[model samples]
Each structure stands twice: as C-alpha cells, then as structure tokens.
Target: MPPLHILHIDASARPGRSGVDTRGSHTRRLTHRFADRWQAARPQDTLTYRDVGRQPPSPVSGEWIAAAFTRPERRDEAARAHLAESDVLVDELLRADLIVIGAPMYNFGLPAQLKAWVDNVVRVGVTFGFDRSRPGEPYWPMLPPDKRLVILSSRGDYGYDPGGRLESVNLVERGLTVPMGYLGLTQTHSIAIEYDEFADERLRASISAAEAAVDDLVGKLARDFAEAAKPSLAVA
Candidate 1:
C-alpha cells in the first residue's frame, strides 16, 4: 500500500498559555497524539507540518486573483509569479490524502492567517468549479473523491452548537465546513474545546475530553486505512 500523507496545519500565533493568539495550543496537543497513532499504524507514512501563525502571507491581491484564474499556458511571466506562493500552498494541500487543521476562534471566526490560506487553496477551476447549466446545482468540486478533513478548533465560548445561544452569530464552524464540503471532502469531523467559562481544572477536563474524541477519530481513520489496504478478490 502506498503511504498516506498527512498535512498538519496549526494556525495559532501563541506558543503557550491562554490568550487571543493561542493558535498552536490545542492543535499541538492533538497533532502530537495524531502523529503518534499514525506512525504506529503506518510506520512508513509521512507527516508534513505547516505553521501559518508564525509566518503568514499577505492577503491576496488583484494580480493574484487574475493570475490564479488564468490558464497556465497563457499566463505571462509576471502573472505566473504573482500567485507562486499561493500556488505552492495549494499544491501541498492537493497532494495530501488527509488534512488536519488546528484553528482557534478569533473575534467569533477564524484567524486572518488561516483565512488567507483558505483563500489561496480554495480556488475555482482548481479545487472547485461552477456548473451553471445544471439547474439548482450551482457548484462542483475538482478535488479527489477520497480525501478527508479533520478540524480541531479552540473556542473562547461554547455557543456554536445546534440550538445554542450564539449559534446564529457563530461563524467558525459554518465557515470552515462549508468550503471543505464544497471541495468534495465529505468525511469531516471536528473537535471543539471551549475555554471561556471554565476554571483551570475544568479547562483541563475539556481538553481531555477533546483529546479522547480525537483518539476515537484516529482509530476510525486507521481502520479505514487498513480496510483500503486489503486486496479485493476479482469476480469471474
């Protein structure tokens, strides 16, 4: 079986402690456990890490927008170079079989750096397309059919669940999941840990609960991988 590639991304700017830019905190813990399980399950598998918090690219510009939409063969030198960084990031995402994103909710939504990464990767004609002719079917995905996405989110407040008080205003889950679904990644799961109203003990408990959820998710992924590795018998 070919080795599965995991693209692990952490969007937190904080290295430690509970603060606004605490991007890497939850993800660091989750990814550490994920990597351990993945390596144990598939010894030959590779893990690629991308830290968007510490080094974030500038927001997309008009030139990048135009260049990204242009046909590769017809693009001028300047236009080709305009989207080089973004293109590279998108390519990394495309090559991965599984993606694990660690994002913290900031100002009721995702961080600016993570948003920029999303903009660069979720390009039309690349990750997705629009099919106007098919009535009521507005969009189509260009990504591979088998990729999976797992999101680990840390929230200051716990109000994003269905029928929750702040569900109407919460944009973090809705924003991320919609785009991921649009890209044909249907097997999506999330681990959300709320830290606002909890004391140190309670916060630790929440983290523990979230970690257990992650363990369960990892087990499922490993089982799926094992099943995929089995050879199918040819029918006469």
Candidate 2:
C-alpha cells in the first residue's frame, strides 16, 4: 500500500500574516506541531499543504458553480479554466486520507478565506452527489469511508464547548465539524485553544493543552497508519 496521505490547511489571517511562526497564532502553531511530530514518527507519510491564510482562493461565483456542475466531458475550455483552482482543491482532498485544518475563530465563525476553500471543494457529483434514495432533498458525500478530518481551532474566549458559557455564541467549532459529516467523513477530531483574549495564564494554559492534544493525536494516527499498511491476518 502507498504511504498515508495528509492534507494540511492553515486558515488564520492575522494582519500581514506575520504571526505564522509565533505563539500569537494558536491554530497555526498547533498544526505545525502536529505535522512535525507526525513527520518524525512516520517520515514516509506524504504531506500536502495549502496556506489559505496567506493566499486565499477566490470566492465561488455563479460562473464557478455553472462550470462545476457541467459534465466533465462537456465543459468548454473557458469553463475548465474558470474552475481550475477548485478542481485542484477537490482533487487534493480526494487524494488525502487525513485532512488537518487550522482555523481561528473570527466573530464566532470561520475566516472567509477558509469558507471559500470549503465552497470550492464541496462540489456536486464530485466531493458529494445528489441522494437518489430520498426525495425532497438528499445529498451524500462521494468520498470513501476511511477519510478523516482533524481541526485545530483557536478562540478569543472560553466556554465554547457543549454546555459551556459561550456555547450559544460559538459557531466556528460546530461549523467545521458539521460540514465534514455532510462530506461523508466517518471520523472528525478537534483540538481547541481558547481564552485568547485574556493574554494571561488562561491563554498559556489553553495553548499547552492544545499542543499536548496535538502530540497525542499525531502519535496515535501514526500508529494507525502503520497498522493499516500491514496485511490483515487470515481468518482461523
């Protein structure tokens, strides 16, 4: 079997993006730490990266939608060119077994940049398809069963988890998880760093917790990848 494929995405859009390598960007640091550990543990694994924070894809437009829905063989050269970026994104996603997204909560939602990337990839008859089984409305992910999504999120406040003080206002975390379910991903995981506005002990503690979670997740995933590569044992 081929090496496990991982897709890494960064979505924090700090002013000038100067904070990429600093503690100021909790999400970005978390993702990098995860990647570093994964690489050390499984050097053979493949990793592909897209930095939406620095260069976000254009928003999906009417033309993009039309081009995407057009039959593969029928789309003209112009349409194909128009959807070039989206096509690559969707293809990259299909090729990856594990997707790692680092998203910072902005006004309780995903950055517009990351949302645009999501819009580009979630194409009909591509990433997913119209569900023929149910009437009214039905859409099912076209992806296989083994794909997974892991999100690292940062927030300016705490209490975003279920039953937390700010859960009602929390949108970024839920938004990221729910969309993947729609995309047919069987497993989704999240590591969050909160209390960012405090810039005190709370923020420090949150970052540490998030980093520890990332390391643990990367180790487990590396082990799983190794196990998956080995052939299954024969039945007795």
Highest lDDT: give the candidate number: 2
Residues 57-101 of candidate 1 have per-residue lDDT tens digits of 668999998887788788999998888888888888889888998
Q: In model 2, how large is the Cα lDDT of residue 20?
A: 56
lDDT of 2 at 140: 73
C-alpha displacement of 205 in model 1, angstroms? Answer: 1.2
Error of 2 at 120 (Å): 0.3
lDDT score of model 2? Answer: 0.85
The regions of model 2 sitting more than 4 angstroms off are: 15-23, 131-137
Q: List the residue pairs that clash in candidate 1.
A: 12-23, 12-24
lDDT score, candidate 1, position 15: 68
- By summed lDDT, the worst window of 10 consecutive residues in model 1 runs over 15-24
lDDT of 2 by residue, 124-170 (tens): 88878886787866887788778878989988889897899988988
| Per-candidate clash tally | 2, 0
